[model samples]
Target: MVTQDGATVTARSIDATRDWLERNLHSTSIIETERFGFFYGREQALREVSLGIPIDGVTAIMGPSGCGKSTLLRAFNRMNELYPNTRAEGTIRFLGQDLLKADPVAVRRHIGMVFQRPNPFPKSIFDNIAYGPRVHGIRHRAHLAELVEESLRRAALWDEVKDHLKKSALSLSGGQQQRLGIARALAVRPTVLLMDEPCSALDPKATDRIETTTRELAQELTVVIVTHNLQQAGRISDHVAVLLAGGVLAEFGSTRTVFASPFSEQVADYLSGRFG
Candidate 1:
């Protein structure tokens, strides 16, 4: 089960997926969608969209405001399930498991998410990072502490907040708080991270820090980011998927190719700043 462009499929067994990854381990895809569609009430938010997200790299989703970029991103982790009358059609495979059929909690555990705004819980930094592990039944204080530290380190916020683990998360700067949000997501040890306009709410410096952190995190995890900023998408992503009205995927390819030569006029127009 592989796409023509060499993107791996997600419907096979885990063993098959593992074998595929091992064989093409350096060329493995972490997630795959085939004819995926989504609906909000009677309105179709996405329609027959398909794409692949490679492992240990960034896949940026770019499109106009109503093109369903975020909708598709949310579907990857079943976040769409939270909304009533929202239905997803077709298959989404993550590490070879059907995301729509899999347990939502389990799907979320393996695919953590970060929102546009920094959403730290109203708790100390220590507790914030420890929340995921605690929910999964990890109660050992030492283990929790180690996980917190490791997650923070991966998120590149350890040095700044390590000394203040017990401090209120709200006390941190906007950039720091965003990193805390990322650290909280990483504490669960997710293999895929979904980011939705993560820098929209931050200042330039904070955005830079988050971008740096995202680059580092890609060394170990699959990253899918939805961003309005075409420049940011070109700068950070290895692959790019451009969406259009009715949630259609207009074009997808290597970052350089997509940005330099889009396949559709819509994509070209949006990228060229002609109109959304």
Candidate 2:
């Protein structure tokens, strides 16, 4: 049973959940949320949600709008604190450390974020990617250059903008700008990257490139993306977490299994385009 809270598993449900868990098992999650809740000054958002995000994997939080997808993603890096009076209850642990109690600045550095739209600073492309390293005290010009190039290559934007490193980042196309955003986040060498609708603003081709970059980055870093696009989730995610409205985690498992055989009626309807 679920009512403005998380699931209440009975004996029958437990067996089905266990079967899915067995099929989806991986290394212990880099992050775990247990009975987690969130609030904006007593206006509750998420409620009693539990999830485990495996290390070095791409886990997509799939749901319709207003389903707490972004809220949950922001919890990873403590980004929700940006709002006044916003707070969380229960626990969101990263590497066994409670992120709610962790230093927000350190947490952000350890887990970078990319937004829905490309948000590059009004600086040269090289400087944008180098800014994170600089803030972390990487001052050597040679080292900064190396990091810049590597980050760009990883984001798949190196060749396109290699000759124009000194140009303003805003001068790039929408797709390039988004890739640059990814590159900037990657340069920080985050343990986990949180992306909130990174492709929502891009065209089809740009979305494809971002998907490719996400997959490649997952090879080395844990990635958690919040996207409403089910096809995109299936294409880029190893595992999927489906959140129902009112902050309930309706279903979660391998991307294929979740998409192929959703655990609940709402999940199945969402997947079938019956209701967002």
Candidate 3:
């Protein structure tokens, strides 16, 4: 078992868990991109973009559509590989590992993701959370139960459905399903969680819950979220990166700094609703 004061890691953990990271890890960062670019066939989606994602914090990637927000987010786990003829250039480092060269499946396991919309399986709620751990060779029923319960609790959903573990996940409300997706990701005990517009499809109350859960999750996990809602970014992020036209990383800094004083006129204009 392992735990960090602010982070709720896991009931059991490996040597590389957050609580066991080197004392000086914060001096580096959770991940860094250097001259990163991406392409789908002949079309370029990102270009010469570079930034650092701090560990165990909420870093919001904010931009209008077609600004490469999702492109950069997917690059962290090599999800870009799903498309034929897709390729990347330059490097993305996760701690000491080269993300572009890392094993895709393993990378995804260590850095889980929650999509723009909820996507729970037709299986029971319990099964949705247990599936990932079980697939990774955790067959002990007692351990699976404990993991599912802890994950759901961390996602702020356990009490709502504790007595309905066997109910079909599809039967739950949209907000509940989204929380279930988060719980599913947490059940794998990842160190980082990537959210691609996680609350875009939810109502205001659901969006608030997701934002709240993300803030809490950041205590133990690095969270990178892509958002079109600048207000949401300001509310939940410690840092914000503004991607601009031509796939450029126009500005990046603390949310307070970036929102209060964007370095670029383009970013400032976008923030002020002048133009995207």
Candidate 4:
């Protein structure tokens, strides 16, 4: 899932899914961050960092291990708040609403997250995708069916499982399960999609399919992804941010620029394989 082009590493881990997103995705700028930081217990996981996420494009967060990439991604939707003794400081605005101050429920409705692992529900695929709409008061059977179809279509999984809507989601392959997870997230109609290394577990062919799906989805939703694969970042991202120790944002710019000419020595070193 990782590739090297001379001095640069082209991360292919999430390339397939991201590529899919780029193709059918619409572009929008739905979130903005300003001087954000997060803490686990008394330890700081992220420091002052700021970035603008375009509404309809893929923005990738990349860095070496323990560089706060995941922590910063969680702040966009306040996912950090779920853990005990976790806190965030600074401003993260999702469509002008401050995430840190907003109700967690409301924030979740606007920003949805997909984890590294595929976690489909034990129930049927139809039920898994319908769960969100049902929770929000959508009860008509017709409405639920429509939502299910649309979500699955958007996730590029309709053709694969259309005939078996009643089958348990766990019956699918790892790649299919991950796409189901995405479809479930999409069922809520979130304005922002946050993915944490979504393709870390799939084979090359499956990964390719997911990348293409992500590119298409970007046409209608904003996406923020945290990935360690540098090649993957370059292939699917319109913008890229490089994180470093102490949660510092070493460099941030267009993917072309960040990969071609990193703004700092540290970023250059990391990308060049000198040191992280």
Q: Model 1: runs farther than 4 Å from truth?
A: 1-27
Ordering by TM-score: 3, 1, 2, 4
In order, candidate lDDTs are 0.85, 0.84, 0.86, 0.81
- How many clashes in candidate 1? 0
Worst 10 residues of 1 by lDDT: 2-11
Q: Could you tell which candidate, 2 or 3, scores higher by lDDT?
A: 3
Candidate 1, overall lDDT?
Answer: 0.85
Cα-based lDDT at residue 197, candidate 2 = 97
> Which window of 10 residues has the lowest lDDT sum in candidate 2?
1-10
Tens digits of per-residue lDDT for model 2 on 97-208? 7788877777787788999989999999999999888877778888889889988998999999999999999999999999999999988666678999999999999999
Candidate with the greatest TM-score versus the true structure: 3
lDDT rank, highest first? 3, 1, 2, 4
TM-score of each: 0.91, 0.89, 0.92, 0.88
> How well is each residue in 1-276 modelled by candidate 4, as lDDT tens digits?
111122221212234334543454431345678888889999998888887786558999989989899888888777778899997788986655576777776677667888889999899999999987776777889878988999999999999999999999999999999999999998877767899999999888888888888888877777888888877888899899899988899898889998999879899988887765
Candidate 3 has its poorest 10 consecutive residues by lDDT at: 1-10
